[model samples]
Target chain A: MIKFSDKQLAIPKLMRPVYLVTAGQSKFDRAFPDKRTEELCIDALTQAAEMINVTPAELKSYIHTCYYGHFADHFGDQLLGEAVIHDRLGLDPLGNCGVKTGGATGGTTLWEGVKAVASGYSNCVLSMGWERMDEVPTDEGNFLISCAADKDWESPLGHIYTGYYAVMAQKYWKVFGKEEDSFRRTLAEIAVKHHGYARMNPYAQSPMKITIEDVLNSPVVAYPLRALDCCLMSVGAACAIICDEATAIKLTKNSPHKPLRIWVTAGSHTLRPADRRDMAIPLLPNETADQYKDLGKKFPGGERYPGFTGFLAARMAAYYAYNQVGIKDPTADLDVIELHDAFTISDVQTYEDIGIRPYGYGRDYVESGDCYHMNPKTGKPGKLPSNLSGGLIGCMHSVGATGIMQVFEIACHIWNRWAEIHGDDKLWKKFDRKKPADWTDLQVKGAKRALAISHAGVGSHVTATILMDPDKLIKKDA
Target chain B: MSMFGQVHVKNGQYKIKGDFHELTPNMPIRNSDDGWKLMGVTNPRDMTYIHSYGGESIFFESLSKGKLMATRCDNKKCESKGSIYQPFRIFCPDCLSKMTVIDMTDIAKKTAKIHTFMVCERSGAFNILKRPIKFINIEFDGVCTILMSYLAVGEPEIGMRVVPIFQKLDPTYTILDMAWVPEKTKSNHLPKGFSF
Candidate 1:
């Protein structure tokens, strides 16, 4: 069995406080045939500046260095795309670097930006992420994505990434789900909810008013995972401006947006799922060792910790982020969350990994409707609303930009501009998307704290980004 | 007609011949709805990559000989000494010591069982696997990690016993050269070019 030293398991800490001054995202879609990737990136940066009542040039002045996230150099057919984008943004001669951690590229970019500010190296930093996936057809795109796997071993098997997740789904279905039809329907509910939430976000893609039945009947990509159950292959961009305390206050001087405190922590595992070794379940603050003593007995064949059914990288990321920010219980402490729902099953797996629910009971989080903006069972708000931005499922999996988009989404609610940004008819028309007649304001009222999980390949890399209103600090020192 | 690229290593250098890439003319992509306006051009590229298996070449070569080769950590100082790896590793992960290669054909035949499985209905471009691929993750009694492979016959279920089969004839000298079938599968039912 694998073991960890105290040093390896130590909680991560930043040297100083970092703040998210503002964030923005471009309209997400399957393909942006007319627009170039730089245009989408510029669109995101412009919106970020507008949110803070500043020009793009004004915001650019504050950025000392830049962190660009653009996964799949092969897809764009451009090596050193960051240099191209950096030159286009007119941020010439500044120290800049690119971050590529598969699906977690966006979050990893933010992690670097936050560190740069926290280390006192930069007063302010720009974290930008984008993906150009529409350059190739869907099947070729899938093949390219599969290259992220262990090329020699896993990629050649099917050249399809869905099959990798499908095996995990099959295991979870038998062990935790117990092969019940209701469990399958519960998975479908997540698709319905994310897609339903997409209807409210003007920038979101695949905004279908689909039902659980529609999801269940959708064409199967891999068994137990259908077309609707998968995340969209998208082209778009998202960006965040991270700054130190003084710079943050300076940048948001006249803006309505608040300088929310931000902390980004990351964790990683073996790229190949075959290499996963058994280990002791690292208990979160909300969990006790006694509660899981009977896990194997309760659910047969579920004895293994993080054996295909769980994301240990996500758990470790949350472990460090929670300790850093003093989050005792996510459901009770956090107001909103955006998980990397790369697939419907991965979404449920994340609920368990992040300690929103205990392991083996992730289905309850959805069945109880605690994940909804408004619980279907009750008219009251959910205990902790999740993925009101539609997540990757209904929105975009613009690889490099996905995690940044999630941060932008949660930031919107905390900034109290969700309705203003999402409901504006001008913004809707700007993207050439029709605003739904019944587009409801999904801003969580008085949201104080939020979390976003950005995950990569199987569970290779994951970053947990926590944003809390500075006034509502959970821990005084934090 | 141009021949496909071929490469061989001799004396620490690559000896290459034939065409490595086929160049095609770029075609303009126009929008018919917008008065046939020019939009973009298709850049078609076909290139073959030369990859070296290096230390693990023995594993691939063994597959064509109907042998299953695995690596075991023989480092006595290592914490995970004696742990066998199916997707053969050149060195022990725990101690970073070069491992010893051993044939595990009998062990796989007797102990291999599906740990988890998936049935994929579609595949990405350049995939040669048949439709409705029954992907299986097999675990052996003594193996610390699971091995991912495809089941050549019957539906897959967790805990179902399976045995390895090799593409001994016209082997591609890749991981695809190995597959698994049900424990009781008949020799005649095996896919062509594969043998027990």
Candidate 2:
């Protein structure tokens, strides 16, 4: 009989025993006129390789397989994959395929990387998501997103993507008796915070500073959804490398000057078909609860859940991640969180859904400065600092690449390299740093554990990933 | 078993004796453009021109003394705004909007100021080869939008006000007959009784 220790059970090694050896990304923006999809992938891959002191050819030797996530305008599947392998990299991968799960593509891709290493099929794998949505005309681009929904019922009525979310916002208002300004104010705070953080990130798109007033007055894409409330459309690529423990240690020794080492603790996915599910009731509530229970069971006694959710699907995923990671008190245990803010309202609602704040108290979390940078005790600057990388709001949404971009920013924060270039501007004044000290110290101490959540609305696909510092692993590899 | 072939020539031409062949004459077939008529598609009905001795005017005096009109320009470039005839409206084909309109009598009498003018070298069904087609951008008195008309005359230039002349088609009606001429031309002036 096998007896599982709490520590050993908490962070399950990938069946293949994978480690995030290196991660890299290209700039996120509404469009990239000079760079194509393949170019962006190559640029990110090259940077990731260099960060770990390896060349593309060198990294290819360890890659047993590669999975890509791309959502281009047209003929993207056939052309983008081949273009990356043959034209850009000049090497044919042993195995290469693609996945599309709407906005959750990024999180799903990371989960795939985790699964690949854990399952032992490959000691090393490369996962990437890239999109170039801005190249197409706006009307035609919108048509592509509409294709993801139930065409028979939704498309015929001229139902726009924003309108779908607007209906949900309206329903939430009626059910919770929440004021419209409450949701709007929460969204504005989120956008302002993320935009503030985005000013620090070089790769973020639309890093301009925005205020709640700006969010309120912006043009309305849908009722109660001003322009600022909606995410921007952008072009970008994010990549991560997952390898086994032995390989990770070997690589680290080979290049001792590498960044932080984070491991995937838990991951869960839930698919809710729009036609079969109840739209009014929050989707995947049961599945999300189960995920949290499972994570808790894995990590017996933690202070908080350390879980966060940005969308309905993200809520379900966060449940599982929190369960596996054993987060007892999320507000105190978790160091940093990155969530999908496809719209402003999502941020407020996600706070409750992710179990971060109680159902009605999400607003208090925002106003109190507990989630953002203005916490008196933390003495940091910015809003919740949740979607600090401008999130999908300031960065805009590139369906396939949006989710992964959130993960990449979170990973950067955990790795502690996020603030290296973030302190040079007037934006840092928000931090109220009269005397400049190392920014990393301001990060939640003992914040070796972090959570990333992503989801898709059309089909309700949710994915969550928990990353932890490898030093905390209970059982050392023999 | 094997097969053998032999070649022979008769009357300075090679002929096959084993198998005889006959020649047939080819006939020429005529093709017509009648089946190619444009249909199911929208075209500029207000842009088609009517040629007459009245110097290429777009309107005519009806038997009832009211003005009748049609489009006059056949140029592909001018199709975007359709030819300005009676209703004298400036239409943009791209945006499909009426940019401006003016009275037909004012155009015929050359009471319009030339905003711009262009001389063309190409001629087809749309132009008379012997006579240069001078396209003028003319703005009538009291009208905001300008009209493009053909100038019959002395080298077309900006600021040139040309009047239109009409030829009587019957006792009570007239047809558009001829190009815009200098305002000073006696035949180009509007009749005393004409109101618009």
Candidate 3:
């Protein structure tokens, strides 16, 4: 059985290091129509084992904490779910429990794993997140997801997540949309780019490449939010094995798994969107009306209004994560990104929210094709290639699974440069556009720093994490 | 790569949105048996009510009688100075002082204007409403916080004065039984000096 024990590791200061030995995910596609939740859980777990050159059974003796993310306990037909899944995977002897926040469930679970390792709670923790959304019909699924909205205010009014975003899309168009329905064009363009990126990601759902023309013609689900502007309802799971420095060093010996020392440096979280005074102000609006008056005195901005729910939540997370990594500027300091694209408007707004661009300038950045991967030979791949694993849009959104999937893709891209398979020109030149490889441009351009941002929990919960390549961080220090 | 690296430690407090069932926007709420019926689906729901939510049963009772009620911090020492507003809460948000009820006897004549609004394709007692329901966030006279409701009438704009209209919903008459209408028209609940 996999085993390594030592004094608990301290974090951030790096007195004792913890590392992400490996990460994995099941096929991120709508292909698994009838898979059981346990089957999908196992599907992802076994793959995570394979990533580290071990079988699922070999992980039994060492797993200490089992953190699982499950957004739809109602849909899954099970309770005490983490216990049940851990039992099925034979990791039950360890303490296990589930944690969730509507959309940020996966990201939150990942943070739990980080705590387990950093807090000296566990040496090897299995962090998994999955959802069985494919079992339900589309309308029912939509309704179930709608339960994430404020049932009293948002749900009754049919201001479901899409509807919420659709209203934001309306305002965004009123502000930034280029021409007649230019906001629609921006969303169509984002869809085309992500679908194109998904083409190479083996685990992606709806990897079919589409043209802007096709996205433009698609039926609208919400005004301005066409069907393609949303994400896929895929049955998928993702897992990562985070271990302390002691276990990582031993495993890396004679193993293909490169220990990317737990380089994740920062994180942040906040409450529901409606708590904010106005939609435009990103963070919690303070709980009461009087508090907004105090907030106005404490943090002044002209005419605060709510724009999108998690803009400030995401901004705060990014701020904290950036601070952890000593990143001065996100657009310039970070190399790769995987952001939640619940809606194209959310994506465009996130560009400014996360400080990549100043507020109100997101439409310009998105329309410039700056988010797409530029060939390694041309502009710069590491110039912050985002959502390469197709993101929530092209990669498939299994709610709790999306955040972990983003982390998995970051690990994949970080290690892709060393994989040797894509080193050959013939195989590498297969696509002119950036596909799933460690796109040479990204690796060559360098810091190898990546950031993954997630927003969920009824449009308020958000988490931002910054990871550094152990080599890059070390080399720079030396 | 060397196996040595620093890991930092810090305790964190995460303020997540609390249980949302009760967090629905503070309103006099009542539910029906099946909400998903309008969505062309079978959803059997219970008649869940916040039950004089915020201990304001008297407030909802006032709405049916065409009276507007609010709460204010009664303590003179309290910084709020007895300013009144919808108390989906029991204590003062500013001073945490227990509040007393205030009846707006002229509630019927108080004018409210549309603040911001959205025309949702569906929203009603049941999830099945299909007629482009208009939900508006409105600012009422003498109220500090914005109130929300369906603008049962009018093409929406940022600032449009609208009058309040209430109808008795059978079985479970809640605040949702009231909606906003355009113009000052004759109504069963009409206040003094109100005319078309």
Candidate 4:
């Protein structure tokens, strides 16, 4: 099973063989009005057990630790969510933890589990992410979510989260988008692609396809960002089981299905984006580069352009993940991706953040067909297959579970049966930007590597986890 | 976090601290001396903030009386030489020492210039804006920190000279009670002091 000898691998001491053994999510919906948080968690866990081809008791026995990630407090009355879940699961709670990192909660929980296994503290761990938003109305939900911003500074100023993203989108347009409604079209492409992609995903919420005109005509929730531009809030739960390399091998060897060796290589995060961090340079080109020749002579860290902190944070996370995985070119190196496209414009900014595309060209990149969903006739990826699970735009965002669900989708591709399982009759390729690639749909056909990225609360938190197909990666490296 | 894990609320056992009272706010809707003119109403989202930190309490008191108070870090080792801070800096950011309060309370508060701004086309908590509200980031003369406030009077231009216009209606107001606009008059100015 070990493809590389100890001498051939320059394995960093900080990194280890953390593998994703199984992943599962309860089908996301606009609002699961009747379902409770614990109910969703149980449903997802049951699905996960079924996918792993193990009974509930057997799977429960394999888990050494459990980490739960849930964001908002107003959603329910479970302050002790992890403890309550443990009691419900009838499992040992010795090394269990409840993690909350705003929206990065799931990614952080997964990271904590990875660390626990890597540190030899536990052999097998479970990360649970769930949120029920149907209990409350949109306004109250937005109000609760807004409370997560800088209360002393941004919140008291009546700053809404969408407003924050809107202003950034406007500036990004001013700098990168150039023409009047060109950026608008770019945002439409993202929404259209993701929604069309979701149509194929049975687990998605917004599987309906929309046009650039549809997005343009949609009610402007915030300037430049239409109702369609933002993702629909979801009610769902997702769970993933992580194990050490030995356990993963044993599980894979014993299974009747095909070999699925998914390695959790690296995970990166940027927690506090708004806090006192040094701004290396201004994001807006309005500020002349020469203005910072001796900027520290007056301003401490140069001009404080308080925008795109989340994007910057995501970029930082991607930088570290790439470094850990020894990747120089993300566009060529990675196969599939599931990023947080809570907003269409966010996905545009995300291309720049992930180093797949440069700054000011995220919209242009999509316009060039480098990341299109799929080509209908050829049944191949147009550019790169991103958000194949339809993403938050299609799959629905249940707050905490969104990130975990992204990871779950990546695992589906590595498992090989991703294509035959999800029937691809109706799709989201209504838009254009036809790029080149001959890979099949759903099955990221010869994909050796994949990444699932998530951002929490207006870029205040970001996590990038790179998972690789062990056999292909090791063979290629060897 | 220690306080949280220190058993703040275990098994839902906690002491009730106070009784609840009905809330009534001093709304901003203009009331014409009622019997003589028109009836007045209020903004339902009216909020009050008692900012009593880092020289903020005194700063608001001075702003109500129309004064532009700034503070300077007194530490000899301060990073920036004679750098000015507003809403008043309590400690020197560089050397971490107490700051020296300075009142640049000029009748010619006209020294400040507009840096950047955006028009809020959407209505939110601030009902004061019937139309799109114009907000600006003002850079005061010799001040190190930027001041974010509303523009009350005219269309703001970058580098436009402006001063504070204190609220005429609200008797109890914060720094936001006043807005930065073109320096049109000096009659409403209340000269407080030169230093604190």
Candidate 5:
């Protein structure tokens, strides 16, 4: 409803064009047993700053703001890290702080950084996120999230997080009249695919390859959600740099290699859980059909298309970005996608919600191999990938840091710098021509147009960002 | 048949005992204006009575079946002759005015909505066993005020509805019990022709 531009038919001036330029992350795993949150954050910040060819002193003057994302108690602010970064680097910016909003914290911070550069507030801004969850006992960590539930009603009645989600899952089954195995298989297939992709990501927390059989055999935690269907809590940090076109060109000109320019199209945050009118309905209804019909109009084609479902919030956010940036067909328009996969079930759901498949046909989309890592559906073999950096399932989830990592991965892939680091065993090799069955061609013929979606569960907050190739924008000249 | 006894002992001697005392009929104790008064007694004529005590008590008077009765007062501020209670009072507690009694048995078994509830995980003197208890506040239908009770359900949602059930313990005493279940049709055993 809030249109940023009308005449230009592109991103509004309020939401300026900014490029990712540089993205760096520390190794993601449970291997860092003794490492504190501050240590992990500084390591990640140092890596990202070094890649941009900017000294700490130079970064301080240009960075208008900094946001740190972490859910762990003391680590949420990373007080010690903030002090060390400022003192050691001798760079004190105007603003620097951290925030938390559960698992969506990472993506939220990245969006904030994007807003900063787009709004002309700062030429260069840094957003960093890290979590040291493995340091604490599992019971204590579980208690932190559980404490958020309504104490008087739900909590006292023996309802925990698993039970809460299980009840919703049960309601879904009851209403749809679907078998439990059907839902279980959907989660298993997604987990297996992400696990397979993790083999190509060096920073994945659990990089070992897995099969559908393995996923099906995994221990069930909450009925349909098996052990493999869920994500692991590991320790790591991801950071990104956002700057205007002039600053981006200047920074890349001085660099040793070409930089990745991420042109953000649209971004927004939507309603919380308590405000929702209907709880039983999917988070985002089929936008192309339901939402467009309500507006009394249709797209260029007369067909009433299905919208994304699984990662409802993220998928909706992505749709807004695509619409704002003049992208009508995602399958034919975008080259790659990096979405939050909090659970394997969410990944399959996202495929459906994002219009990658027809309604109730997400499973077929995965089985058909068109959306596979190296598929030629978009005409480029092994180019149009989803969650190429292993996503949240493969990477460590420091709640707020996961979303920023999605943007960072897309930036690295577009810059062609990602494959150079494939030498590291920590990085997984996703595209293997020898095993053609394991790889699918996306068929993307031109440069890449990337999309990212972020979601916050407690309040049901969702945000989406779209990045198009700078060359395309240059050609359009609008 | 009647039985009575009396004990006797010498006043100043510890070693010697006296003969048995005579057992006589003692007069009932009474309160006198000029002498010592007994524990619980009131004068009939001189007592300042708040109201006339004649015919039958209001509670007993109403149990005769079809009679709709209430206490009456002459106060000018009496609104609707003061609100009526089940036993029916003649005067209002605020205005002290007489009120007309109206039959409310037709609507007595209706439902109420729960306002709030608290779950008690621990009960005094009980340990090693966790018995969940809920304390709820409910607003009855057509009643402006709310009542508090121990909710029978283990967990109470905010807007659950409940029905009141009444049982007569004796000719002089009656008990009221309320229970909440998922909404359903009233049982056939309920009084016929009364809408809930």
Candidate 6:
């Protein structure tokens, strides 16, 4: 069993308010043969500048330091890839550092930038992330990703990271899902919804109009997890500009939108799932101790706190973030969310971990159409629409860039510009993609707050980024 | 003639011999969609990496001898004292003291059962395991941690009884040297070179 002291569980605090002025990303795809990695990064940075109606040079004058997120050096075969990008961006002599925590690199990079501005170290900071997975073949890429696991014990089992992650899915399917056929269909529904959402996203990589049947019929990578249930291996770049209140005002002075208040908190767990010990479930603000007292009786083999089913990192991140931002209930308090849907099953797992739904009932979030941009059942806005950006499932999982892409997506919704950015005909033509005639606008009208979850490894690292309009503060001090 | 890389420690340092890498030529990648224009060059690399087992070498060494080793936290002051770790932790997690290595071969043979399992049909490059690997996480009676290994024979299911099998013949001196089989599996049904 494990325990936490009062100090360890104390809420995290920023010295001062930090705001996200603007964010942007390049078009994501499986491979970019004709373009260099720096070119993709420049595209992302240029978009960030244009979002604020400022020239690239004008934006550079506001940035005092930089944080870069590039997950795999071996994939690109460049050790100092950050230096290369920083040099190419022409931000010379600025103290810049690289942030890498597997898939959570993008969120953790923003976390660093937020701290810099909050601590009065720099007025404005730049946080950028990208990945270059197209450098190697798919099989070789899998082998390299497996190296993230315990090299001596786990990696050699099949030299595949999916095997390590699949064991948890197997357990969750049996314990929480109860191996029910209905639950299996619910998992398939997530794939259909994410892919459907991707159809409207011009920058998204795999915009398939798939169905539940297609997902079920797809080839199985691991039993109970088909190819359609997995995330894409993509190459792209994404970035955000974090600034203090004064700098945020200045950067967005001539722009149409005001800056959104931002807060990023993180948590971690053992890299190997085997190392997770039994413990009591860390209750979110919405949960009570009595709610899970008979979890084992309710669902047999579900007694272990996180044993293969839950992501302690995500739970703890939400724990710190909700308390820090004064979020009493996520489903009612937040307007929109973007979760790291690494797999369809893991997507449901996060709903429970982050308190979107109670443990063992995450399927209801999808079945009830609460996670949709437009509730199919009622044709009304969802109570809390999630992953409108297609998430990692239909969108890109370009490692370091994934979390920033999510932030960019939610910011578009809160800024009430989702349709303008996603439905632009020029962007579609520029990316060589066809705009479906039935393309629907997915903007959440009058959205004021949002959240995004960035995760890494089999729950080794996780970050929670919450963005809210300054006027809609839940707690006056927060 | 070039041979596979070999290394041995001498005078507290690595003494290496033979070839550790191979030279390969780069090839230009041409785009067929645009008049076969040159896009990029493929850099071919083939090399071997040397990894030391360090303090955990005993655990791997014992696998070939048909013994299952685990570490126990014996520090009296530690809150997690008396805990047995199957993955063989070099030190106690709660307290950083070196743990006591204990042979849990009998415990694993008698009380091991599958906690969860997966049947993976795909594998990454350089994988030596057979297709559709039956991956199982086995839990022993007294061990605090579950051990991740592959099933050498039979289908895997949750709560299924299993026993450890070691590659006593031509041991690989790695985690692959050990695998698990369902309880009461006949010796003839075992994979080549593996025995209970």
Measured against the true two-chain complex, the DockQ scores of the candidates, in the order shown, are 0.82, 0.01, 0.08, 0.08, 0.01, 0.81
Residues B54-100, candidate 3: write the lDDT tens digits.
46666677667656566776778865555666423356665677678
User: Taking the tens digit of each residue's C-alpha lDDT, what string does model 3 give over A1-478?
Assistant: 1111232111243334567877777766563533556788887887677666776776545578889999887656466667777778877567887988778888888777877788787888888998877655666567777777655435655534566666556555544443346656767888887877676555667776688888877776666677788777777888888888787766556456477754443233323332322332332111224433443343232134443322666765665455445666776666778988887778887887677765556665566656767733455453567887678888788888888888877776676642232233443353222344444332324436677876783347787765667776622431
Q: Residue A150's C-alpha lDDT in candidate 5?
A: 43
Instruction: Put down candidate 2 lDDT per residue, A1-478, tens digits, no spaces.
Output: 1122465334344443456777767766665544567777887787678667787788767777777777543524245553464346554646766766777777777777778777788778788778777545565455556555444323322224554455445434433324456656766777787766666556667666677898888876655566777777777787887788777766656553333344332232222111111122222322333343343233322112211122435544555555545555566556677777777666666676677765444566677777764564467653334666667876556666666666666665666656542453543453233323423222433456566666675326667666666665423441
- In model 6, residue pairs whose N, Cα or C atoms come closer than 3 Å (at least 3 residues apart or on different chains), thus clashing, are none
**How well is each residue in A1-478 modelled by candidate 5, as lDDT tens digits?**
1122344233343356677767677777753644555566666676666666776455456666776666555333244554454344344645766656566777777767777887888888788777766544454445444444443223322222333333333323322214456666656766776766766565667665777789888765544456676676677777777788887777666565454545333232222111111122222223333433421122221111111123345444655555556666666676777766766655665565567664345555555555556543454354346776667776556665677777766665555556555344333332121222333222224446677766554225555655666775422432
Q: What local distance difference test score does each model get? A: 0.93, 0.54, 0.62, 0.64, 0.51, 0.92
Per-residue CA lDDT of model 4 for B72-191, tens digit only, reads 866766556477665455666556677787887662274777654445555443333334455655666666556556666677655578876654444344544556667663444422
Shift of residue A210 alpha carbon in model 5, Å: 2.3
List interface RMSDs for the candidates, in order. Answer: 1.0, 25.2, 5.9, 7.7, 17.0, 1.1
What DockQ would candidate 5 receive versus the native complex?
Answer: 0.01
Predicted candidate 2 versus true structure: per-residue lDDT over B81-141, tens digit per residue: 3344332323442344543433355344545665444453322222222333444445554
The CA lDDT at B137 in model 3 is 60
In candidate 6, how many Å is residue A343 off? 0.6
Q: Point out the higher-scoring one by lDDT: 1 or 2.
A: 1
Q: After superposition, how far is residue A82 of candidate 4 from its true place, in Å?
A: 3.0
Off by over 4 Å in 2: A1-13, A72-87, A254-312, A376-384, A421-446, A473-478, B1-196
Give the better candidate number (1 or 4) by DockQ: 1
Interface RMSD of 1: 1.0
Worst 10 residues of 5 chain A by lDDT: A299-308
User: What are the clash counts of all predictions, listed in order?
Assistant: 0, 46, 28, 4, 39, 0
Runs in model 5 deviating more than 4 A are A1-15, A52-61, A72-90, A148-162, A171-177, A180-183, A254-257, A261-275, A278-312, A375-384, A425-447, A474-478, B1-196
RMSD of 4: 11.3
Score residue A407 of candidate 4 by CA lDDT. Answer: 84
Which ten-residue region of model 6 chain A has the weakest summed lDDT? A270-279
Q: What is the lDDT of residue A265 in candidate 4?
A: 29
- Candidate 3: lDDT of A253? 64
